[model samples]
Target chain A: MAKLKNPRGLEDSQVMKMSYWKILSILLLVYTVTGGFLMEVPRLAIVNETIRSLYFHVPMWFGMVVMFLTSTLYAVRYLKKPGAYFDIISVEFANTGLIFGFLGIVTGMIWANYTWGTPWHGDPKQNGAAVALLIYCAYFVLRGSLENSEQRARLSAVYNIFAFAAMIPLIFIIPRLTSSMHPGSGGNPGFNTYDLDRNMRMVFYPAVIGWILLGVWIATVRIRLRNIEDKILELEYEKNH
Target chain B: MKRIISIAASLGITFTGYAQEPEMADGMRSEGKIYVVVAILAVILFGLVAYLISIDRKVTKLEQRLNDGKPR
Candidate 1:
């Protein structure tokens, strides 16, 4: 039998040429070391020195947002093309996004503990973030419980649309309406000002980009693996039959 | 034991004096800063974990498929 070519035509691509895991590791190492050193610097620190957490917390939320946005894109593609690959990519992105969302909440809680004198202050931002995360978690559970691939994909795609729509209000609008000890709320205008100085921005912006790239790199690896697994499963079923 | 007792006594006196002074009562504002740094690091760690897990699941699926195709 002739060898089947990669359907996505990525097998020979430059992106597939390099080891994603190694590149991701190197980027993570650099981010950690540089961020750590910058945080330790005496003068650059803010909010009684708790502002250093911004590097970690803000980036996770940014990464999560990126993942969810990617998921939404794939969901749209799935609706149009009805391909398995798109569904897989969408679910994979959602899984990664949820992990980042949970981290953002944890880090925010820790920051609040020190600055606001408690881990949780019933802040609007906190509550809204929690609700958004829970919605995505439910999406995953719903997908898992379903047995049929086509049904799972269609249902998940529809749910993803709704989840993404709700996310806008939960993450951006609601936080703005109510009181939040968090920087950008309660009539006290958040990070829009020079809250993050030029020096902070130098590291902060790169951290966001790096983390998002890292997220994509991971999702690609996952998609590739899923393809391989499907091929093997097909072979096995053929042999059995 | 005697030296330990003396040290404890000195520390108590120092803390009492610090508490009495309004300025010193604030303790080093540096603690708050450290907390912030820790919180940020925790978030980054979570993102890292998310990335790793996504990759791991894919690899596992691939490996399982490869194994399933082999002859018994």
Candidate 2:
């Protein structure tokens, strides 16, 4: 039996061992079981009511933040290494991050509609998130418009770094300056004191971990698929030439 | 055309009647629209889950093909 070589020169066994999805599935299973049990308990109903969205929404934001941070790291590494693999990883992570970001927005809107008056109030947090999303959207558009791979990677990396730097102030800092209907508003305590209790933390922490792992898992799968597609395209081009 | 006009005329009168003194029940009726919104969102969520499952299967097939060294 012969082993196939990965394009990056890693062995097939190594690739098989790198299954983030399997780990994520296990984490998700644990979360579902625990969350279900927690919801059923009558004593924690008050804590669980509004905080339930925290499990879904906070995890999404955590995943998005992690993805963007990881992509930034990869972008920097790509600039240093000048490799296609890093570029692919960065791009795939960005794409996955955007998916989670969009989910976060949807979940936040639904929660807000129930808690606030409207689905979308002109809140600073909402506007900041929208801007951050648009910046990432432009990053993809910039990549699409570029003809050369190296140029695309370079320009996109630069843009990724800038967008991420801007995102920090937009999503986190600037939102803190304004009066927001959402939690963690101006001069208000955030996720501290009475906001998050022990019971809520139990599920909330795990939810963050589970969702971040899931995001990474999804990004890894996307990266693998993209790598394969690139290899196939290269092979076809070689054959044609 | 005349029948359509009469129907429109009657609807217009009915709307004017309600518009003059929009009853408190109309508030409840508008609030009921939230249920419709929730239902639509539920349907969308179901559709998204279904689509995601399909995508997962496709990805599995693609991965298997890649492992087998088949062109796709």
Candidate 3:
């Protein structure tokens, strides 16, 4: 691996390298897709074979939450240190998070249609997730509206923090408070020994980890591309001046 | 004759007992066709990951080019 100097005097780790986690992500996902379909799932009455969706669908939300959490942390870092690097990281993470969230919602709707009798059940958890994604979408809008790079970074950093805060309660807390059709909410028995039993956890946990790593890898690629763009712009300005 | 008749009846009972299990894709698996599906999915996953890796390599090359004191 060539040692590339980060444009902003950031640590060497900030410079992207082919890491072990990327390999792990690939391996885990391969296992998940294979095992998810073939493995013996609980023969639940309503879900039956569709219960396999748990391995695929649930990971998207888990990956999204992880990405958003990382974004919020970087946003907080930007507030304290005030650097373009942190801001870039924050935005790219949120971008990947949004992708995961969209997949989560789409896959969820498909699974719900067969199990819940409708695509949009207006379940508390579903609404909460939709509301949470909208809040993050507004974060991007907030960033786009500002012209100045510094101003855009600063304002969006604050908004990112707020968005994460709202998402926690909306997606996690509110669903539990209200009677949600979702499992593990509103006194419904979650995927415990009953549903997401020991057999499923073997695949589900790795699937979540694998997907989160994949999301991070994607965000890092975007961040690197953005860095290249910034460097080109800086070099161009220097040449002109 | 009675013994042969009892064996036939027990065979019929066992077949029905086997049918009582929860319906799964056991037929597909028993016929060994599910491996085809697994192979197809694995190939797709590997293909996407390989593509992602290539993009990552391209970005790394760009980073190296810029860091080499040459502006592309």
Top DockQ hit: 3
Candidate 1 vs candidate 3, DockQ winner: 3
- DockQ of model 3, rounded to 2 decimals: 0.17
Cα deviation of A2 in candidate 3 (Å)?
Answer: 16
Put down candidate 2 lDDT per residue, B1-72, tens digits, no spaces: 233334434554565475533122334335675345445644664565456445554565566676777655
Would you list the C-alpha lDDT of every candidate in the order shown?
0.70, 0.72, 0.84
Give the CA lDDT, 0 to 100, for residue A40 in model 1.
36
lDDT of 1 by residue, A158-236 (tens): 9999999999789888877765556666555546332547756666676777777777767767676777767767778
Which number leads on lDDT? Answer: 3
- Candidate 3 per-residue lDDT, tens place, A123-207, comes to 9899999999999999999999999999999999999999999999898888878777677666443554335387888888898
Better model by lDDT: candidate 2 vs candidate 3 = 3
- lDDT digits (tens) for residues B1-72 of candidate 3: 233234434554554465544355778889989889889989988999988988997787778678877545
- Name the weakest run of 10 consecutive residues (lDDT summed) in model 2 chain B: B20-29
Q: Evaluate candidate 2 and give its CAPRI docking class based on DockQ.
A: incorrect
**TM-scores of all candidate predictions against the true structure:** 0.70, 0.71, 0.86
Clashing pairs in 2: none
Candidate 1 residue lDDT tens string, B1-72: 233334434554564564432122123334555445546766776677666655564465445446554332
Where in model 1 is the C-alpha error above 4 Å? A1-25, A28-32, A39-46, A187-196, B1-72
